[model samples]
Target: MLIGAVVLVLGSLFLVVPFLLGNTGVTGFVIGFIASLIPLTVVLLTVRLIDRWEPEPKRLLWFAFTWGAAVSIAGTLLIQPLFALAAPTSSEEAFTYFMATVQAPIVEEFTKSLGLLVLILAARKYFDGPVDGVVFAFTIAAGFAFTENILYFGREIASSNDPGTDLVRIFILRGVMSPFAHAVFTGTTGLIMGFAARKWHSGYAVLAFFIGLLPAMFLHNRWNSMGQNFLVEYFVVQVPIFLVAAVGIILLRVAEGKLTRQRLLEYARAGWFTPAEVEMLATSRGRRQAIRWASSRGRGRAMKSFIKGATALAFTRQRILSGRDVHVHQHDELELLRKIPTLRAAVLQ
Candidate 1:
């Protein structure tokens, strides 16, 4: 079922691309789609590395990404045309301004943010932490961006009767610099969604999520408005805003990385993992490095089994840390998972 959903959503997004645009050369359209897709691929790899606790199925990941693209593309297509109706009689400036200032932000934010609600309501187990929330939201946003690039790129190609310039701009703006734009916009909702999931309160989730989304939309729209005036916007606004957003995202990831280590440390001290094992889980990079080091020595599968076992051990330790005795509440499943690390240690000798 999950696989079906992923395929269905992805297929639908592919169909939507050509329908939305009036004109586009096949080469430029393909370039635009591929250009937008590369970032989406890189970020998913990052998500997989970070989310060891309950890594979502690859199928579900695709479903989320595809859903974002399909829905957001449809939304902008349906609404933006209306704004074109409201286009100013005097100049193209009015049409561009209206789309930038009024239509795009509201539609795009809502469309991308639908993923938070979907994940929270439908797939409860996958909702682990802020990173998961961000990953989900970003995938959805990427999906939207992918379809959007196709439409806008396709139109530009058709209008100019030459796809060359359109391809270059798409590569720079949508492909390179702006992948973060949709992700950041929907992230405010993710922050709220994560809090709500942790609390297990539905009404609270909706309230908090939208509260975050509304502000995000405003910021997104503001950035778009300023940014359309490139010369003035770059020096006066865009660069500074980019720097701030970039720094903020870095801080959040750093804090998340720190907490992950701290949690493992606490678990290790409680005997959920050995002091040596906890050291490995402290950073995913370290864990991978250690695993590669082990595999080179011919213990590859055993090492992965060891990490999986360690994870179960870590979960048991977490339960213990949460409970009265720090030991009594842990059950049989945890015991079962702990054996892999034990086996790995035995092999190490």
Candidate 2:
């Protein structure tokens, strides 16, 4: 908690200093910040949906966001200039193109992915599977997009001759059309790291990070390289990619639900939970019905807590099976086991 507070404070400074330095006036900054939240909210809601099965720790989620919005963005800003210094004294247009297509994708994805690595190394117990990976990745991407949108919106508002017209145009383009671009790009890395977390040791998980960067960098490069024919490329290439990603996420969510049921069945065999309780805790419809039943008895919150604890128990079982860090997960397993019966009693009462 103390570390999270320190990161939040430092991240806030890193984010604010850039806008201040850019002379994005107070009006522009405020308007930009407000406009940015519209899409940020949408992105976060989508992430919440993906993460519904078993939520990651809130502190880690916040860390992912801050890393993207502040640390990753700051790293990109600092490194890209050094690349500029090394590049040949070429035409301005060519340099801009190179930076956009090459430098930004490489630098941005690397920095964004570093957040995932940090979580895997520092908080391995929570970083369980691919869905968790996508959740964290999407969160970090959301934060980055939020910050980037503010800068784009504020600069457009401040610099454009027709702020109203340009604001509408840019908002439609960035806010409505391509808000998930960053998430899609960085999610590749997160997905890979997540698989690594489940199957491999920490050292191999580090290797997985670089392997995942391949697709992330490629997708980012493709998106930025679309120049004059933005509409054509967007429809032909980007739309299909986004559709594929969405479908993949849906499939992963279903898999997560199934996995939760399967894991809890083991507990049922051990008498920690009944088979009926596993069914109630694992399925969407079952959970909803359980909640409604609990609410009718004025135990809605207790039911919710019971469901959450049971879900955590299932995932802790998963971590144990994976053999990544058995000793640590064993402790969590015992603790959850101890807590679950108390939570269940509250729901029954």
Q: Provide the overall lDDT of each model, using Cα atoms, as 2-decimal numbers.
A: 0.65, 0.88
lDDT of 1 at 223: 71
Assess candidate 1 and give its lDDT: 0.65
Write candidate 1's Cα lDDT for 1-349 as tens digits.
Answer: 4665566566665657557544456755765566656766655565555455435567667767777778556556666777678767577777788778777888778767766776776675555456567667767776776677666666666676556776677667765766666766776677667656654556766776688688678878877876537667755765686678557656656665565567667766766667766767555676788789888988876777666555545444443554423444356345654575576675485
| Among all candidates shown, the one with the greatest lDDT | 2
Candidate 2 off by > 4 Å:
1-16, 19-23
- Per-residue lDDT tens digits for candidate 2, residues 17-128, read 6654485666778888899999999999999888765788788898888888887887787788887876666798888888889899999999899889988888877887
> What's the CA RMSD of model 1 in angstroms?
4.5
TM-scores, one per candidate: 0.78, 0.94
Q: Candidate 1 — worst ten consecutive residues by lDDT sum?
A: 318-327
Clashing pairs in 1: 69-143, 69-144
